[model samples]
Target: MDEFRFIDSIKPSYYRQSSVIKGVGDDGAVIQPNIGHELVISTDTMVDQIHFNLNNMSLEDVGYRVMVANISDLAAMGSSPLYYIVNISAPNSVTNEDLLYVYQGMNDIASQYRMDLIGGDTTSGHDLVISVTVFGNVSPKKKRLRSSAQIGDIVFTTGYLGEAGYGLSLLDSHKHDKLNYFVQRHIRPQPRVDFVRVTTNVNRICLNDVSDGISSELNEIANASNVSIEIDWDKVPIHKDMNHLEHSRLKQLALSAGEDFELVGTCSKGDWKLVRSLCEKDDIKVTEIGKVINRGEEPSVYLNEFGEKLSLDQSGYQHGNS
Candidate 1:
């Protein structure tokens, strides 16, 4: 179908939020910001084969993946999702029905978070591309930032890591026997938005979503906060499915492979205790991986493996690096 028809076809019957004054079928989307809250916005773009491969993932899965990528950023900021805008384009080979599936995919995940679909452009392109911008709100008092970590703070993670990257590998190798858990993680990973919403009552928590892997996120926290961080290799959580992988390879996946989308953060000891209990009560696995320290001139992340202290480089998925 054409662009206007595609846009009109996916417009919601009703907006999820009353704050959305003008959504689809408009020159611009107008939103009313809530009082006593700051807006948290995040956007992500996914290319055809680079970000996703249709061999293993469907267009709808791509839509959900892109939407989650942005929502996960809001989760890292401890914000609640409010609205989203999706811009999609594909080549002539893709039918209107295909685009419908894409929009259906976006709606599938977004509706769960009470996010309203706002305005975005739709047009033809050389490749199937999807861009999503998510908007959320956070209380100014409970801001969670990468630079908010403190010395003596405890490092923690919301859930298991490296599954998504491993999942992609499993898909690439056509390992159907071991595909269910990891494949789902690769295509339809859930953001830890609820965990943050429940456990962020604490005053200070430094958070980075594991979109780019734990090492990258940890280094970001350390650099942003100007503090050194050390996490034991044995403490990092990996799935039982990955236990058979070689030592260094498994650790590398857990440390450097990206797209897991878990939340890694630091908070004070008391605050960590409180959040740990709260997370358990909510049935979310929260693990104490290590602690923040002051041993380095330049802020850096160190992973303790085989009793050896090794500095962690910014090792994760970097677009266009390959």
Candidate 2:
């Protein structure tokens, strides 16, 4: 939940690199020095109480999340992750063995993605926290942006919505499960890097990771592109465990709940067959809930099922919330 507020405070030397890359503005930064190679950079921070609780979170899961969060940013930009830098801050209450386990978790996932750990920083703090910065490579023209969404582009989401949010609901309800699949997602959410790798060849015009839930992501895209979104509430996919009642609230949950780290994107109508084929080959479910529209003067979200334009009470979870 750590925020970046200091362009002039953190490091003034990065100013030179800012022009070369789309720095400190977009979901991730970009650098396209060569015509053939473009560089992508993104950073994420998880703090003790803001992002996770140490009493419930395992050291390994925290470590894995340290890497996954950064990788998610790269995936959203339609780039391939190459390397990462991680910085850890922890209190003396954490043992050296615990920190080593965290590093081991980082190494394990980084290897899976073939990302090399180039460098990082470690320091003592009052609480446990992790910050990871990831670098990826993409073609200059191929780098997707949130603002690239066009009016008439179909909206799509990779995989189900509200599963992680549903998982949190269960934990809040005190119903622990032996499966623990959803809980792990909350702790160690898997970034859809493989999905990104395949979809990069498709017509994904604009893309963003659904970390802050689907509603907030859609709003971001809408605001960026200055278009309205009309999503089918029934079409919003839900996990099998989530029954009709749960599914009914999924529109609200998926829209407002944070930490559902799926890919939300826009594609042209012509690419439907190709996109569906890719989803089939990869065994990922994608649902088309809406289309970009220029009907309204102001950008808004409309729910077809409710037959009215819906308003969201929450804009995903913000930092420092209990």
Candidate 3:
């Protein structure tokens, strides 16, 4: 099938969210925004070989992973996903049926997350690249920006760290398929949208998706908030499966191997009580990983590992540097 036919076929499968007044087949998507709410939008792209490899991941996993990466951005902002646009560029090596499988993965996430797939472009290219832009909305007062961190606030994570990174490693090493827990975490990360939804009424927050790992994320928050943060290595949560890893490898993965898709953020010490209470109600456990210590020029992040205060470098995957 050609580009137009592919778009036509997927039109009916789109999840028509109330906010999307018009979707697929149009020049643009028409969206009805909620009154008194702030619009939250984020975009992400994944390329074959650079971002994903078929040897370890299916085309569908690539599609699903890209969508979740975008959705996690919305979750970090404490917003509910409303609509999304996806652009797929496929090479001669990629077939129309393969694109459909990718779409199925995207559609699955959209259905499960209550967002609509609206409009985007399809093209033949030298590489298989999927780009997604997601739209969400939150109360104006509840917006969670990386700059929102405050001194004395408690830093937290939505779930276990390092699982996704290890999962991808398992696939790369050809040791386990996608069904493995760590592998599943890498391929299909669960965005913390539900937790954000439940705690929407909480105080202002500082948030960054652990898309690039906690080290990079914490540095971002520090630079944005102009605040230094301190955290104990032992406080960093990990899966029981990761316990077998040597101390150095576990530390390396938790610190710099990104794509966890969990939210790392901060709230007032008092507000954390409410946040924890709210999360526990849904059987979700948000781990308190650290605390903001100072606010000033030249902000930095310090990790308390092996009872030593060690400053962290600006870490995680750099797209073009590799």
Report lDDT (CA) for all predictions: 0.87, 0.72, 0.85
Could you tell me which 10 consecutive residues in candidate 2 have the lowest summed lDDT?
A: 1-10
Over 1-322, each residue of candidate 3 has an lDDT whose tens digit, in order, gives: 3887788878865455766667887888787789999899999989888999888787788888888999989999888888888888889888778899998888788878778878888898998989999999988888889998999999998888889889988988998866888899998888888888888888787889998888899999999998898777888899888999997789889988989988899999999999999999998879998899875457888887665777776773222200
lDDT of 3: 0.85
Model 1 worst lDDT run, 10 consecutive residues: 313-322
- Model 2 over residues 1-322: C-alpha lDDT tens digits? 1223322222223333222444443444455454577889999998987876656667887788778878888989989887666678888787666777787787678778776555566677898889998888888777888888888888888887877777776665667752587776677678888777777777556888988887778888878778777677677777776665444476556666767788888877777668878888988877787888784767765656545445432263222210
TM-score of each: 0.96, 0.83, 0.95
Top candidate when judged by lDDT against the true structure: 1
Per-residue alpha-carbon lDDT of model 1 for 184-245, expressed as tens digits?
88889999997887876788989999988898999899989999898888899999989999
Candidates in descending lDDT order: 1, 3, 2
Give each model's clash number: 0, 1, 1
Q: State in Å the error of residue 28, model 1.
A: 0.6
RMSD of 2: 8.4
**After TM-score superposition, what is the CA distance of residue 213 in candidate 2 from its true location, in Å?**
0.7
